[model samples]
Target: MAKAFKVPHTLTLLFGMMIIAMLATWIVPQGFFQTFINDANREVVIPGTFSLVEERQYLTPWELLTAVPRAFAAAQDIIFFVFIVGGVLAIARRTGTVDALIGRLLKKHSDKPQKLIFMVIFFFSLASGAIGTAGEYIPFVLILVGLCKAMRLDAMTAVGMTVAGYGVGYGASAFNPFTVLIAQGIAEVPLYSGWWLRAVIILPFILIAFHHVWTYAKKVIADPNQSLVADLPCPLEGKEATVYPELNGRHRMILGTFLATIVIAIYGISQHGWYLYELGACFVGWGLVITVLGRLKFDEAAESFIEGVKDLTTTAVLIGVARGIALILEDGQILHSIVNGLSMPLSHVPAAISAVGMLVIQTILNLFVPSGSGQAFVTMPLMAPLSDLVGVPRQVAVLAYQFGDGFSNMIVPTNAVLMGIIGIAGVPYDRWFRFCMPLLGKLMLFATIVLVLAVVFGYGADLEVASVFINNAGVVS
Candidate 1:
């Protein structure tokens, strides 16, 4: 008998990547790009300023061992944010709100599961595209998993719905501040300029994503053997599987309080400039309010909160290790060398082809640099100027940045948000990789086509107008 080869555990996979990154420090040339703060108050790379350092910077094996804690410290904001959301949602689940809602959804949508799938993908996509929501959706992962099980689908289907919306929204983001806004501002294009195309294009991407997920879901429902994670343990095991509490005033209050918190959080983000800390505080506040409303003894609520966080331990560790991988590259000083080498050839290509080339470069770079805004900071300055040399519009470059960063997040091991989602869902990285790679191919193909069309049509004409207006205003002064 032949035994099947197995995928390593998530921790093993992440640590393996960290080791590889450490070894690369010894071999890859250490280099850097000179940077300056632009008018927008961003530190941006000065074009053509790349230089190899006289002394090489390489990380030691000892440093690789210690990078874990340092990465946790660096990513503490996101880690704590995940904890807060998990703890708060656990308390809500104890209130029977989650179970009640699941029961209601199953009754209403079970007959036509496609409706549930579409709505889930659409709502998630809308949130990510409009307001840059990703980590906030962590609370929904288990909730959707339970609902899908009730609807006779598998865990992979649940994950596919949540992440597909998230990934595609980002890929075709009309105005995501984390990726698009930062990329645009760094590229020196007008803020939110040339957004109509993204807004229009997002629908098709969403539809394609919906079709892919629904198709898989249909198969899983038709035959249990068709499920990707059938052999894997249940994510909902050891946790409350489901509850059908009768609707009560307290449950409504909790649901309202949760929805109100999201609205307030969104408002704070768009207006007062909130980040993870503020958002975490908001979720914590929701936890406190629900605690009082659910009438839990202090000890009971506290235990539930701790239990909720306990389940997410793997997710947090994976996130920290993922950050550590990026840290190693930074310490090695090979980050800029990779960026400099990959971008040079694009300068020699035709405009339309160069536009597509930017997409490819951004996709490859995303594997090394997974943070959306972080990638913008590292890549945009070069991509913005390179657009001029190759006859691609700066706005199109920003679009390339958006498309590349958004879709690749689904498959990139360094994407902490992704690791968190699938970990919480109990889907192994190998299984997730198997499911997501094909979808990424389709979305990437669509994005490449759009970038070429944008180049053909001159997408950034308004950048010239905006620049002229700024220059004329300076002349008057």
Candidate 2:
């Protein structure tokens, strides 16, 4: 059999992709879909209103270099959030609270690692599926790695329980504002309108993910050297994996503080619509309190915090450069062109086929536009109308968009969050993909079947024509 294609170093591959996005601007006609502000106050694209405009925005070589810096500027909120998360993790680690807890748990369940695996994966899945908390898990990636080692598991298992678990939740989310909510709003469906079906679909996918990760983890435990990154310098390299300090009362208090903050964060997200900036502040306050509680002298705390930042410096740069890929596409004004090209084929397909086709297009588009909200804003406008022509419900199109925007992030090099977290844990892209591809393939298959059923059954098919901004002069009748 021919060898499968391997993704390159994350940076090298992303920079190359950035150049491809730039070149696409020259080849694809510059165009955009007109947008309108909805009652919910979101700037969603006006359906069926795409037009060819004079192409004014183009990137020169120097302009391309400038895009990286501009991306950093535009993404400062996320950039700082990443730094703050790193510092918080460093403080927590210094307190030994995280390690102590992991140690105790391992000691208690050392003979029943499968129970521990399922619980951790499920916790992450619920957090991500319910709240769209993808990036917030980065700081915990290293901590999970430590725990996995203590249980005789590999880096893949650690990520599978955390990052991939989040991916399943995120991909199958019924109410994630960044993906599901925005796409539904654009499709003119009630926010979280068909959550019952989505909730049902999410369970099977999570179970599939858990089984795959658990099986691999058990194998690694049996033969420790069988681990994919057995030779890599992991975050817990040189530490004894089998032994952990007994948890003291102070440690319990610190952990209680951390857990309470997580609950508060979730509450804020669910009720108050808090996002990255506010969540970053939560971590900031957590770090301050933990540092004082742990009684680390100022100099010692500062050193650990800086050391954490230094470790994540590469991860941070990878994220900023990944942002450049999207920026170049936006600057080149080819993102809409690509969307237009992808939408053209669906016009003639059967409703069921068109629904699945939307999934395929959105999945491919995710490689170029990795941001969930960004992809929703770009694709949902066109997809919703295409669904109307083919007799599929607009909500089904939103389903396609949400599923497409999500699962691909698990393996896409352009996904800065996944790549950054993997890099921090010393797992190569190739190794991670090897573990994720088969599982992701199964999830994609499941998603396609669900989408086809939605189309056939008219799931959430009600149309509120007056609420939708139909382009009378454009494609809509």
Candidate 3:
């Protein structure tokens, strides 16, 4: 008998969330956190400073329609970046450079392809863990798809190697200034203080995730029909998988140019605080350089680049739709209420339970507040004091926030980066969720265990021997 199957379209799911957010405005009391820029120019929530705010306008049928376009306006930067990067990658592929490189590499590793898979996983993890390169790698997903197809694997495997790997490493980040730094500051702990411990906790979890992906990859290789998208026409379908081509001089030049530009982009990010636009410019520049060197006709180059953009146009629109959920929550002034509701109960729990509770709360809150820095501004000040009263280490609280904010992006529809990456790969959100659910469970369980250990061992700054009471008057020594 054929099994029952149902999974909502990604846009349908996102629209459902927007409807819920609209209803929430009417049901949940509208509240706001008064925020001010700190000395570091970061906006932080003031503990005990939340107050009921008047709703500017209740969500109406028309507002729901406008919210999507407004969200698209808000996300123009990221959208343009996606278009440019997609175009560049398409141009490169059209040049036959990527195919040539893969042909050579796969021919050499045909017997031990798992070795190559593991290497890709580790490299992606390191980039995300060490430098906070989560969303920046979306363009690389297509390249990974190319690699996976060449190995007779599926697109989900490419996602596991790139998106999932990035999420795991990013969630278990050691020194990501965007998440760890802001969280440490608001939690009143030294920045990067818990790097050694974070590394110890995260590395093992990432290894487990890698093994999980590799196992599925091997299974799909053994039986192609077992792949999740076996019925759909995959981008890599019908491609020449066994043709081995020698890497000619033109291929080497293109590859070298792209690799060197990536290094430069990394340096720009680390040293100059670059973001999407700058990174997108790098890809555009590389594309132009390769086109000129390869001496492609203008029409040919433009056609290839436009085809790439066409392939990813759906993804770009989905990103805007996903952003609409967060947009509505913010405009409704109910985001703070959601955070307050989730965190208020931790005060009564035991110290260990409270720490774990923060992780659970943050995980849920990430659905509404997907931005790491934005969530930090909204939740950290309150969480820090709550940790103090319950004798949970400030660092443990930060870890909970880190794990919640980073890892949940792997599955959250509100997260445009996740949606965008998977959309580009042509994997539906439900299918991707089914594949990553088991691994996400493992990561969360491991995170909870780590939080328990942190509390048991007094992770990070020592809890003050003197009770730091938090009441109506605020923190008391």
Candidate 4:
């Protein structure tokens, strides 16, 4: 058989286009090309350049230099925490504990498809909540994919469900320190004030995602010879089982300690809200439990931990580089420029269109910067003020951020977790996108309509909250 020839042109073109677009965004002064509208009447005119280099305030040179190390440190800290979790889980898997647990759970649910789908969504949602960081969710995603295969489900279907469930949950997060608290803090709203409302809005999307996945899986099962099935990549190779030496008493004790630690951690979080301190304590406890349970020497455990951290080094580096792009945009004061330029045109649109527009913008921004915390830092300051000017409440603006950030994760090329998942599943990015884009579109539309209705009905602060008025006697004096 003659092999088909392939060209690398597409990859090269994509990289070239990305670089050019980034450079264009970087060099253009904030608002440089946004002079078409008069501020008073919002009338259009010929667009002209407006440089902020002289008038704009931004991070000082010293600040920029200082931020690099600070950003790297923060990235490293996140990577370290994720690695510890991964290492502990890896050790647990090696002990056959996780395998036994997964087997039992799968068997219990396999008889009921609806129950199985709900269970999958529930666990993925729980993992998203537990991990609290998109980057940290990679291992969980891979685990879910493997579990799906074990249940004889289609891999892509599993990926779609896991991504949809997790993304929606994370989008409507109630207590995520990174996304919810940080975004609310930046918007100057009381933390978790609109949380219940946010959850309400996102619930429909979550249900839609469940339906989407279940239907897709059934379609594949019913027609195994479908073209869609042919398009998906083969199951990942080299998945043969391996035997390990029977655990000694020390290993058993260690395994028991590790399981107990996890239970305690979950219970504590449920009883008392999870804060940074709690998270730190959990990490330390888990690491110790794994070290003791694995019956490994200090050096051996350290090596395992280090190896886990090393696995995350590439992701950490990517994060830093991505952060650098934000730094440069901030340094150039272009982020503000970009926001200001878009706000007026968006405001002129109908409320529904404007709301959807905000979602779209946030999604594009997410492609370059996937960290929710980092994005909030860059966008909320601008978005909040703009929302007030455009007759949208601060809560709506926050929701827009959440919608854009969360939904786009399923499609964005820059999300490391998505890439990691694709790599693990042996599915190509294009194939995953083709399968997921329609579902994402439907959910995005559903969310947009919900937001539009909320605004129309004056839900949240838009309803009861009003500007204060002080009046003396109606005097002509």
Candidate 5:
């Protein structure tokens, strides 16, 4: 057989774009760009004081070189964490802990495929929300794919299901500290205010995802020769295979410990609130538990951890390179220019149209700037006020940002994890998009409709605060 091939077009294109964007950042006069944006916002005062004066402290060539190391360091932190989990998972697999538990769970849920799917989605979604980074979900994705394959379902079916479920869960996240709370924080909404409303949407979205994947899987199974169902690269061997295993006593102990750690972590987040510090503590505590309960020698566990981290090195580097693109756009002030360019045309439409316009704008911006919080930081201040001027509520504007940011993960090249997962699955970017775009459309449309309805019903940012009154207020008052 021909040696498995690795193509780097996505990575290459990302780097090339970053270089071009960064160079333009240095060459474009910052003053010229700011003047353009200031002139664009009609409702707000175009403060003469707010001039586009370019700060001349462009990153030196040396500084650009320095970003490489800094990027690597960030990547290292992510890789180290993954390595620890992966190593323990590998040990668990070798010991047959994971396999046994999965078998038991499957048997218990055999009569309810839909229930099993929902449980998996819910469990992983909760984990992603608590962890705050989708990187943590990679392991679960691997496990899902393997289980699906073992059950005679196509692997990509698992891919579609996992990614779509995650996107929906992440989109309507209740406990996501990173995307939800962070975006809310930037938009100045109180924490947990939107939880009940968000909760209402979760089940529907998860069902949509489940149906989407089930349909796709049935088609592939029925027509094995379909182009989309063509053979993918064989699954990664060695440590990657550790997430699933045959059931045994050691496996039961490790699985129990893992489940307990998850329960405790959720409790910790509820008590302490979700923050990186709390998250880090949870990871550390879980790692220690897995290390001790699995009974692996310390050296063996450490090696597994290192291997897991190594798996993500490429992704980390891609993330850093991707971040540089945003930094460059920030320096050039071109990001503002792009927003200004979009706002006027969008503002002319009716309020609902304008709301949709904001989502489209945010979607465009997301390709260039993938960070949910960072995008909100740069765009929301302007978006919030612009939304009000265009007769959209501030909260609705936030929802627009959320949909725009969340839905495009299915397509964005700059999302390293998306790319990394696709690479692991051996699906081309174009192929994945072809499969996912329809589902993305459904999600985006559903989310848009929800936001529009919320706006129509006067469901503003204060819904949660209102809930408190309903719970606590007296008729006399």
Candidate 6:
């Protein structure tokens, strides 16, 4: 009899990627990009600074073994932030705020399933576009999963809505500090130069996402057997909420603090340049406030927080390991080579095709460099010069970068936020892949069109009015 091949767990798969990266260090050419601090005071690579490293430093077995710990250290901010969100959310659940909110949401939109999906997709996308939120949605996964179960939908529907919104919002990010703003700063364009186009584009992409998710959700609702996750055990299998708790003054107060914390976090991120540390502190403060108002005994609140963190142990591991993949590639001294090699072709292509090629390169690189800001830093400098050579505006290059980074984020195994969110929802990586691939394809198609149109219409009017294709020999034609 033939044996069935079970897909590896996310952790195993990430470790395998790390091993590949380590091996690439030995096989791939060693190279590095010279860096300088730009006007933004950010370390950015100087154009034409890429060169072969004089000495090849191959990472040894000990380094591979230690990459995980190094990655944990590098990713601690995000890891701790995720834990804080989870713990505080768990406290809210214990206080019945989660259930009460779910009950109210379901009461308002359960029978109106399309409305619920649209709201989730729209609001999630809006947050991502506006504030660059990604892993922040992890706290919503289980809540959405339980709510979907009560509505006779699968967990895939829940995650699909969350991830689609995140992905599309990022692809069409207007004011996203993490991706768009950083890319713009690195690209040396005026801040938010093409905001109107990005703002208008997100709506259509959101519709595309909403339609894709709603199609799958409708099929699953009509026939549970058709669910992509039919065989996987439902997270809320036995505890389906038939009766949702009513929101009393206490529950309402707790939920109010939740919203207030989010508002304050947004203000801080936009006005004061807040990040994981501040966001985590805000959530912790919210947890204490809820504990007081929800009237959870000190022990109960503590237990709830502990249990929440305990549940996310796998999630934490996934996020940390995912970071290691990039670390291995970086330590190998091949990351710049990968970027250079991938981009070499664009110089030979036409302007419109070059724009698309930039998108494609960014998409592939996202698998290795998953962080939005990190990808921006690594690619934008190289791409900015390359865009001038290939008849692509520097601004369009930034747009393509955002498209590649944001859209692929939904499916890239190396993306810690995607893995963390699915891990919490109890969805297997393969299952999430199966469910998200179509949506990703649809979004990518729309993104391709947008990139092409941007190239045709001169989307970034403020920068690079003259785009001339140049050859490697520095001859412009």
C-alpha lDDT values of all predictions: 0.88, 0.80, 0.83, 0.60, 0.63, 0.87
Better of 1 and 5 by lDDT: 1
Tens-digit lDDT track of model 3 for 139-226: 7787778777877888888887777677877788898877888899888777888788888877787787888888889899999988
RMSD of each: 2.1, 3.9, 3.3, 7.8, 6.7, 3.7
* Residue-level lDDT tens digits of model 6 in 196-295: 9899999999999999999999999999999988888876555455678898988887777878998898898889988889989999999999999988
TM-score of model number 5: 0.76
lDDT of 4 by residue, 84-194 (tens): 565655555544555554565566765565667776666666555434544434445545655666565666866676677678767666666666776676665667777
RMSD score of candidate 2 (Å): 3.9
Clashes of each: 0, 0, 0, 1, 7, 0
Deviation in Å, model 6, residue 22 alpha carbon: 0.8
lDDT by residue (48-158, candidate 5, tens digit) is: 223456365465666555655655564454444444445445555545555666566555754554555666666655555444545545556556655655454555766
lDDT score of residue 297 within candidate 1: 76
For residue 77, model 5's alpha carbon misses the true position, in angstroms, by 3.6
List residue ranges in candidate 4 displaced over 4 A.
1-18, 30-51, 55-87, 123-136, 174-177, 181-191, 222-236, 240-288, 291-333, 420-427, 461-464, 467-477
Candidate 2 C-alpha lDDT tens digits along 1-477: 999986678678677878888888877888887888767676667766778876566678887889888877876777777788887788777888877888887778878878877887777777787878888787678877887777778777888877767888888887777788888877767788889888888888888888888888888988988788787777666643345667998898888888888888888888898878998889888888888889888788888788778777777777788888888887887777788888898888798999889989998999888888878877887777777788888878888887887888898877878877787787877788888898889889999999988888888765534334455546565
Arranged by TM-score with the best first, the candidates are 1, 6, 3, 2, 5, 4
Model 3 spans with C-alpha error above 4 angstroms: 1-5, 54-57, 237-244, 463-477
What is the lDDT, from 0 to 100, of the residue 91 in candidate 2? 78
Stretches off by above 4 angstroms in model 1 are: 1-3, 38-42, 238-243, 462-477
CA displacement after TM-score superposition, residue 28 of candidate 2 (Å):
2.4
TM-score, one value per model: 0.95, 0.91, 0.94, 0.71, 0.76, 0.94
